[model samples]
Target: MNSQQPSLAQGLLAGQRGALARAITWAENADRRFPQLLEDVYAAVGRSHRLGVTGPPGAGKSTLVNQLARHLRELERTVGILAVDPSSPFTGGALLGDRIRMEERTLDPGVFIRSMASRGSRGGLARATVDAFDVMDAFGFDQLIVETVGVGQAEYDVVGAADTVLVVLCPGAGDGVQAMKSGLLEVADVLCINKADLPGADRMVADLEEAVHIRTAGKGLWMPPVVSVSAGTDQGLDGLLEAIQSHRAWLEAEGRLQLSRQEQRLDQVQRVLREGFDHAIWEGRGLEGYARAMIKASRTPHGAAERILEQLKAALPSEWAQVQEETQP
Candidate 1:
């Protein structure tokens, strides 16, 4: 462990809010001390139920999340919220910050809220979102909610990381057909039609219900429930919460919670490995010069890429040689 890591880990374990914030910052920046900090606190993770909220930009996702957080606190549950906002073009930090609207909960000691910039990361989440969630979980929050920037269909990555994914859609926002077209239904554990009192809300709900039914009819798969809510009026919020709880109960009863978490952790491992490889091979090993040299030799980009792959394979340990040979055509 590094010099500052132990103290940080101890402070985090002691449930210090400052420690939690700093730890998340370390995760966000990919700081050098983060790995050891995580290692020291990893065992405390997995206790918090991660809920991911995402959808179209005007879906009222932030309002719904605020309502949900308020309701959870009413139940005496400690909550940690990571709101991933769009990046500022220049600073690469959260543009709206949105924390201003969450002022009610901001002063509540039981609630820990952080806004992260998308930082040009795709899949509706900042690359550091899960890492921050893990640290928040280790800090002993009973529930953690992740709200994505809701850029579009590609934002499904955040849902994959959560225990339950709530895809919120408001009526007349391209209609429910757009949801189906964008493949949003495929990732929804619970489909929340917010602004339920709107003119087309019922039609939107019906469309989604039919879509979910058709998609899961013969597969014996769990069909995501379509629930309606008016976050603005605080109406039907209970039904949304009930749907989330029902899904959680189903996962628990079917013994699938651990399996799902394991899969998410595996995905995290793959992401971390890819990042590490990019840093090690491209930056540490000076592979950029080699690429430039190959281009200077009049090689096409694809040809140069193949040459680089060969070099990478050659540098691998002897144990991989036979496997590499067998895979080569």
Candidate 2:
């Protein structure tokens, strides 16, 4: 982040919290030097387990994440939390108020919590979520928790970014049926019924357990474990941890975890490419005026888009030619 890379990259590996926060800020802002920072810390990436906690709004994801951070801290594991929230319409920036929910954890030296704005990204995840996770992972956190905006049922961004996806549901939301309808069960590695102290919690748990059994029966796939937890009272924390550990153990066996991580990295690569190209074409090279002129000349939208792509393709490095066909839409 400076003239000397050692000050930033080495600082991160040296366990400096300032370096860690600055590194994540570089990611959030899409700083040009971010690629270099990543190169400096690439060796430390892939060491942390990223847990994505998501569900419908008001499912108490922040409180659950708060408790989960404490749980991991009790085990003496360092934790980094990324809470992605909806962008403020006025500022187009993260409304940092959500940080208050995890305020207690901030007092602990081992825990780092950052609130990010969704910035209109689909599935309630910021486009930079993966990058921020990579930075946090490189900073030596044993565990990383990504808490989504919890906008709704379509949260595949978490599924792609997190190694273990915990879909949190609660009672009185009719979330069991909602989860089924929204295919939340399909993406979840572990199903958590939060607010277990509330009425109808038992019935909700039973329903989800039966659903999981029914869905995975005879499929030979890892059936998602259904666990209920009352984050407010801290009940069923061990059960929740056990369920998560069971899934993690399964992923670790037979190199499945490595395979899964490779797939996730592939997704990250595509994401980086798309965002990079979008920025290059639309934000630089005067393509906006070119596009406007072409459109004003009565060119079809698709035709103008094709010409822009042609310009981009021509400017690309020769080494990228082989992959052009596959990458092009």
Per-model CA lDDT versus the true structure = 0.88, 0.86
Q: Lowest lDDT 10-mer window, candidate 1?
A: 92-101
Scored by Cα lDDT, where does model 1 land?
0.88
Residue-wise C-alpha lDDT for candidate 2, range 76-160, written one tens digit per residue: 9999999988887677866656677888987899999888888768777898899999989998899999998875656688878
Clashes of each: 0, 0
Clashing pairs in 1: none
Error of 2 at 260 (Å): 1.5
Error of 1 at 276 (Å): 1.3
Q: Residue 36's C-alpha lDDT in candidate 1?
A: 91
Q: Which digits, one per residue and each the tens of the lDDT, describe model 1 over residues 41-77?
A: 9999989999999888878988899999999999999
TM-score of predicted model 2? 0.90
